[model samples]
Target: MEDFEILDFLELQQEQQGIDKTARFLQKQIQNGFKISIVIKKQHKFALAPLQQKKNDLFSKQHQPMDVTSQSSEQTENNDKQGSSTSSHSSVKMNKKLIIPPTQNETPEQNNNEQKSEKSDDDQISLYSKKNCSFEHLLKDNLLSQKIQTGLSFMKDGNQKMALEKMMDAYREGNEKLKQCQDQQQISVLIIICIQSLCYASQLLMDFGQFSESQKCLDKCLNQFEINDFDLKCKIYITKAQCNLLNNQYLQCLDNYNKALIQYEQINWRLEVAKLLVKISFVYALLNDFTDAKKICYEGLQILQSKLSHTDPRIYDTYYTLGCIYYLEKDYDFALEYLNQSKEGFIKLYGEQHLSIIRILNLQGVINHLQGNSIDAMELYEQIVCLYGDSQNIGLALVLNNLALVYLDRMKFKSAKLSFDKATAILKVYLNEQHPTFKRVEKNKKLFVAATLSYL
Candidate 1:
């Protein structure tokens, strides 16, 4: 028998008894020959045992059938030569075949299990890749894109509060996963859509009278992306203009609004031009330049009349500004007509409970008073007083004070005193005690007192 035959038999036995057990059995067989001793270093002991056992098993199994007397000496010499040749062959074969078992501690089944595990792992990775691609496709068509469109529609309809909430939810949902995705072009498009949605949401917040909240949202949107793009920079300035308007910083508001107007003009954005005209009119009104205010208001009206439908909110904004201008100029009849048109438009667009409607109601009362319809004026004032009873609002107080003045002019001193006192009490709470309006209210109180004394 040759060493190759012995090795083949030992491998068969190892398959039956497991690698570790077969190795120990063969190591004992090696110990019986010529008192061969092994001196294993502590670290090498585990590694050397299996190799030594395999060598011994090969020698014993191959030489067992040879002549034990005459051939023993000659066989020993030949065995040394065979060992060298066999080792050299094994070394060469090692490059092509991985036939050696891992160790005494490793089994044939373990190697099979390991190969199966590696194959399963690769299949799992492939499955995950397919799922990710499908998920991204679904998000692009069904989730993120649809959300962006819905949010934009809500913003356009002046349902800004709801639109902002939805836009922010969409932005957060897309941002984390979009960052990690491999589709660079798709991710870039999604990011641009999200930023645009957020910008619209911020604008809506400004429209809905949440100036600080709108500013914070704008800051977050700008922080998420580069603001250096011309279009995006224009939006940033427009948002800042809205904030300044709400903060009553009229000059800053005018400056930013003009900046936005210049950008819109250069880009030929007609709708944006109309919108900026409305904003500029607001600033002009605040500055008490009613001429400039009326000019801008008419510019917006012309744009809306030509481009937008009758029921559009931009038309209402234009009419509303015209009404405000006439009211400021004391043109009662024209003011009443424009304001009534504005009121109907707003009611159709946003319903009567909106704050914009409240302002219209107050303006209607002023127009009635200017038209000498005391009965109608009183009715409107009483309705507002009921609607916003004890509310701390400077505008409401001003309306109440104006209504009292109407009564005082008619020598209805008792009703005048009542309205005056109510307005004063509200103003005292809502305005600073040392405010200029407080002095005006004091003067009105003195007139009421004098009227009361004369009536008594």
Candidate 2:
């Protein structure tokens, strides 16, 4: 009987040890699988740390209070079900499903709750996708947006140089995603600002006689203007007209000017209408139709004189146009009178060194030379040369070339040869070989040189 009792106690101890070992093994497996699931879900929400923390808090609150006895009972029930439903060979299949670990033996309600938790995590991640990304990527996008904004600000304030620099940097560095976002947000204003800056840059290039570059800028500006920006469209058309005029595409320029004028008329933009009239007059002059040029000039003058004050900028343009018209018709006395009035008006509005003032001075010198006032013409020419400093400059070259004619007419053969040589050298450097001005200068130089030799 004693031996039997001892054997029974030994059997009980061994069975208890086996149960404890099985429970521990199952608990470890469940904990490991729970940890892996948490990690995988955490990775999906990498950008939303606050949401992950909330999930962890919810999990702790639900699971932390369970006692070991209840955990053990749950484990035992799961183990029984698993052992009955799965064979040793089916363990691999069971592992593949990644079902809730046997130690937990979750109910249907608990499974549904887990699914809801996962769905919530996915929804949260999708909602804050932009905020959750890598800090480096986020910071880079922010910097690019800030740069674009700065560029737009500079453009708004009329600082075109700085605006262009910043805008170009943003355009180069910005990613496709950022561009898409900007488009979706209707941030076309930034693009418009960049286009406007390019237009201003083109204007500066035109001033320096860079016609090809200026045309390219105008093309880009026109491409960027949408149907909604009627004002910008009208302005771009006007600019294209001016560029066409500069490139000697007279008919095309007139067509563009007419189109712009029609748009301005529709918009009731009188200032723009007046400006277009001046451009039309220029085209007429280029066509050598002095009658039409004078007619346009008088029409513009009537509108400006009646509607605008003497201090207005349009007044000077009107006076200058009248002077050019009279000069073209060989009315030298009236030309000089109108040109002097234009010059005084421009000097009052803009300083003496302004381009308008310089151009008027050049025209005045030509009119004086035509009127046989050689002394006055020579003095004006000398003043222009001194102000411009370089005979090769466009404004100065025009004056120098005209002054050479004055000397030739006076029969000052040596002085004429010297002036012709200077003008030819400047023209050769500044004007294209095929340019009319260049050919004229060459012809005049040859005549002056031949005259000088004959006189000698």
Candidate 3:
């Protein structure tokens, strides 16, 4: 025990000598005014150093460096870590050096330059997103317009099936609620889609002679309509007017036309006014008021002559209306004269195959039949029927009714019944059993039955 204590005392004295030597060295350095400047060489710009680098920084100190054996072991451990950690961290910042503390000449705010650079990058990203979004919206609107145009072209070419498919594709999107829209642009898009869909659907229904369904679509369109859109408003009212005319609702037809006319005149649209005049005169002619009908027809013709050329469509429309009025008055010669004039004008404006001439051909056929020119009338009716094929065209159906009457007069009961059946089938697709056109065909069918019975 005594030998162990003497050895411990010798060890304690050696440790004290070492402590005194380090203190004496530090005091000499301070008295000589030593300035310690840490000049760090950098390889990467990062807020945090790698594990090996941190170890090197912590262990390597002034007047005492890590021994070579310890350094080699640390390097071996860092190599092992590199293989496992490189893949995990290679995606982060590896090209720029770490941000360091500010120097004596630098302001505190200068250290925040990295953060400001990051913020600017974020703003550029946001601006690019907004530009892309605006471009997409433009493409969306143009695509919509193109589809609507394609639908309109199909309608004009009389391809109802293709037209329906095109319209459905154009219409059935963007159904978000207008109230839920966050901006005026969103609300406008919804309103445009609604109006285009409803208007095209209603007009297509009207062309198919489905007046009730057409009216329903038109009613919905009115809810989305803007009051300042007089052109579209006039179109809707005219469609309504035509529906009433076909259904034999003369008073309602007049009311609809008057509504449209009021707006046209308010806008001082003379072209539309002149056209409406011709149509309104026919309504009067249908009521057997020949004097007022002729008066209105001439008034419209004079306005048209002043505004349009001799070959203008409105001029031909005026002539057709006059022919119709004179026909109702049983002035067959005058009716034929005006109808021939209108037919030639229309043939010049639209090609011979165009349906624009159908109404004129029909009037001429009726006049020929009344004048005992059954052959001419038969040719006219057959021509119109051939033009439309077997489509459910209301005009073609009416022509078939007139053709059947010609057959009845000539004692061709079988032919008359065939024509009557075709007309009835077409009208039934469009009109109810009680509609005037349907009833007309039904009433004529009795003649076919009676004649057949008498012959048998």
| TM of each candidate vs. truth | 0.45, 0.54, 0.60
Q: What tens digits encode model 1's per-residue C-alpha lDDT throughout 272-341?
A: 6666776676555545556656766666555545555778776786777777666555566787788899
Q: Judge candidate 1 at residue 317 and give its lDDT.
A: 64
Better of 2 and 3 by TM-score: 3
Best by TM-score: 3
Candidate 1 wrong stretches, greater than 4 Å: 1-253, 282-295, 305-307, 350-355, 389-391, 410-414
- Candidate 3's C-alpha runs over 4 A off are 1-179, 207-213, 351-353, 389-392, 424-436
Number of clashes in every candidate structure? 0, 1, 6
Ranking by TM-score: 3, 2, 1
Error of 2 at 212 (Å): 5.7
Off-target runs (Cα >4 Å) in candidate 2 are: 1-190, 204-213, 224-227, 288-291, 347-355, 389-392, 411-443
Please report how far candidate 1 places residue 273 from its true position, in Å. Answer: 2.1
State the local distance difference test value for candidate 2.
0.49
Q: How do these models rank on lDDT, best leading?
A: 3, 1, 2
Q: Which run of 10 residues does model 3 get worst, by summed lDDT?
A: 1-10
